[model samples]
Target: MTGASGNVGRQVVEQLVAAGEPVRALSRDPARTEWPDGVETVAGDLVGGVPTEAFNGVRALHLFPAPEGVDAVVAAAVAAGVVHVTVLSSLSASWETDSPLQRRHTVVERAVEGSGLGWTHLRPGMFMTNTLAWAPAVRAGEPVRAPFGDSVAAPVHEADIAAVAVAALLDPARHAGAVHELSGPEALSQRDRVRVLGEVLGREVRFEEQSRAEARADLLRNPWMNEQLADSLLAMQERTVGVRDGLVLPAVDEVLDRPGRSFAEWVADHREAFTGPV
Candidate 1:
């Protein structure tokens, strides 16, 4: 699977291995990637064009929305006789307003859909792992500071996302030509999520609301973030607060035949990241 080392992709790889499937995991740097026994690791990048061997004898593929070389990647998959593909897209793609984030995934989606191959789109909402950004504050026993403390989102577990992807990959007839909008079982505000984290870690974590200016300044200071993206994200959060933007969907339960995991479950599973060394 392409993007096998990524957050959701790593779970996909592991679960696929646990199911006794032969997985060909693609990575930009194969030397640094650790794979389960009997799994093949390939050195490849979506932007650089995936190595042809990675597609050889592969029937189904899991793809990430890397727009730059998406056409080439799909072409290679088709040439190698790949029949089905499950793409990791975002909920932004379904938004009414246009955005760079949405456009990037839309471009890749169009290419894959136009490729004449069976395709399933996995469009997930905010990920539970996004809360990891507060790890440092929690570890230091500091209040988590951010704007829109009451903004709610049904943050999905990375494992659940991967499970849905793997299901689609393994059963094309049931999932092909489908779009799955996955989210967590329940919606929680930012502060509510922090409380859940504290509950799971057996500690008290406080929340501090940051003014728009403070949040903007903090976001701008991050070298990895920029003004446009920051402004867009903040705008979204503003819209979500005291709204129904966090509506939990039934796609996960319908597709996987089980309830989607909750934020508390995710925190319990990842408690170490907040509590430090065991």
Candidate 2:
């Protein structure tokens, strides 16, 4: 599995391990991460060429979207006798916009679809983990400041995304050629999510809304972010403001035969992130 140490990929690796499947995990630094007893950790870089030996004796592949060499990786997997591939994709891929964020995942999706191998595209909506960025302010006992505080999204749990990917990898026949649009069980505005966090942590968490420019300035604090990417992110959130609550999809529930985790549940699970050491 590629990106075996990542958010969703780590969980995918864990779930596969729990299922007694022999997992060959590809990581840039294999020794940094401790894996379960049977997982074979290998050093490979997706941005650079993924080592061919990583695919040897492998059948189904769990793929992560790397900006470069995606087609080469897929081709290597195909050549190594991989019959099925589950791609980690974004909901933005289905968007009508022409932003790089949308095009990035769509390019990977198109490559996998045209590969003739059995494929499943897991197009998950906003990840609840994205809110972890607010942890520093929350721990500092300050309000979480971001633009589009009123923007609504059905932020999905990373576990659900990994679970769907695991199901597809394990039962390729049942999930092949499927495109799943996943979301949380309910829609919640960014403000509402802060309220949920407050309730879960038993303290009044606060949210301070910023203008688009302010948010862009804040995002630029990251040296990796440029003007265009920051604007695209803000624009994406701006587009979601006031979106209907019922727009939440049921793919997560249908695929797992259970309702997706709620934002409140996510907050409860991550309460410690908002509140530091007691």
Candidate 3:
């Protein structure tokens, strides 16, 4: 699977391995990637042409959006005789906005759809793992600062996304041509999310709202971020405030035959990250 070391991909690899399925994990630096026994690690980058051998004997692939080399990756997959592909896309692809984030995933989705391969698209909303950004502040017992404390989001567990991906990859005929919109079981405001974290950690975590100007200035200070992307993110957060940003969909239940997990469950599962030694 490409992007096997990513948040969702890592869970996918783990779940696939737990099911006794042979997995070939692709990494830009294979030497640094640690995998369980019986899993193969290959050195490759999606943007730099995935090695053809990585596709050998592989019936299906879990693909992450890499627009730069997506066409080549699909071509190579077809040439290597891969019959099915499950792509990890985002809800942004379906958004009306024409931002770079949306365009990037949409391009990859279109390429895969037209690649003459049986494909399933996993379009997940905001990930629960995004809350990890508050780790440093939480560790220091500081109130989480953000521009929108009441912005509602259905932050899906990465495991749920991976679960759906694995289901599609294992049974192409069952999930072929499916576009799954995955989300958490419930919607929670940003403040509610912080409360959940506090509940799980057995601490009193607080939420502090930052003005738009303050948030913009703080974001622009980071070299890895730019004004456009920062503005886009803040705009999204603004739009979500007092709105139902999380749309609980039936796709996860339909595919997994169970309801999607709640954000509280996710926090419980990841409590160590919040409460463990810093």
Candidate 4:
């Protein structure tokens, strides 16, 4: 697994562990992590490069897409004799507007599709975990802010996405060439999710919609954001506000042999973020 330390990657690691699958985790900083006792953790930088030897004994890998230079990763995985690689992609992939993040995924997907390595693409919708972006304000008892609280997205659970990844990794024949469009069991607006959070936490949470100008101003104040990315975030909000809903795949149930989790359940399980605890 490439991003064993990230949100989705962490969950995928946990699922792989429980299934007793021997894994070779790909990580940028091995010292920072305390991986499970039995798993072999490799210390190397993915952004810098993915070491070909990491895939030496590995038959499959969980990979992430960053634009920098992943041709090396494709070569390394192929050289290591990897049979399959699963990619975590997003709905922004349609590329009607050329989002930078989408561009990164596009680059990696194009490379892997022709890289001679068998592949499966898991394109999940808006993440329910993105609600964590509101954690600080939610814990502060303030309103969650966005440019379009009215935007509707059939967001899927991160764990569910991970589940699909683990499923495909373990059973590559079933998922090869499959592009799963994952989403929550139900379609909902941003406002609807906040309302769900409120219902689950027994507190009234509110959303404040910032105008495009105000949104840009607030985003620019952050040192980490550039204009293009900030504007793209706002643009996604604008695009999703009335686009009906995205495709919800049954691949989850078919692959995992159980129904996928729901947003309300995800909220209920992780209610601590909204209930005053960090």
Q: Pick the candidate with the highest TM-score.
A: 2
* Residue range 1-278, candidate 2, lDDT tens digits: 99999989999999999998999999999999988889998898988878888899999998898767898998998899999999999988878868878877888888988888889999998899998998998899899898898899899999999999999999999998999999998888899888888888888889999998899998999997888878888988898899965659989999999999888888787888877752
lDDT of 4 by residue, 81-158 (tens): 889989888767755767776886878777889988889988887888888888888888889887787887877889
Summarize candidate 1's per-residue lDDT along 100-178 as a digit string, tens digits.
Answer: 6788789999999999999999999899999988999988889999899989888899999999999999899999899
Query: Considering summed lDDT, which 10 consecutive residues are worst modelled in model 1?
Result: 238-247
Candidate 3 local lDDT, 1-278, one digit each (tens): 99999999999999999998999999998778778888899999998878889899988999999899999999989999899999999988889868767887989999989989999999998999999888888988889998888888888899999999999988899999999988888888889999988987888999999999999998889896788878887888889888873367778888999988888898888877787665
The reply for model 1, stretches above 4 Å from the true place, is: 220-224
RMSD (Cα, Å) of model 3: 1.7
Lowest lDDT block of 10, candidate 4: 242-251
Clashes of each: 0, 0, 0, 0
Q: Which stretches of candidate 4 lie over 4 Å from their true place?
A: 95-97, 220-224, 246-249, 276-278
Each prediction's whole-model lDDT (CA): 0.90, 0.89, 0.89, 0.81
Better of 3 and 4 by TM-score: 3
Scanning candidate 2 in windows of ten residues, the lowest lDDT window is: 269-278
| Candidate 3 local Cα displacement, residue 219, angstroms | 4.1
Model 2 C-alpha RMSD to native: 1.5
Judge candidate 3 against the unseen true structure and give its global Cα lDDT, from 0 to 1: 0.89
Q: State how far residue 129 of model 1 sits from its true place (Å).
A: 0.6
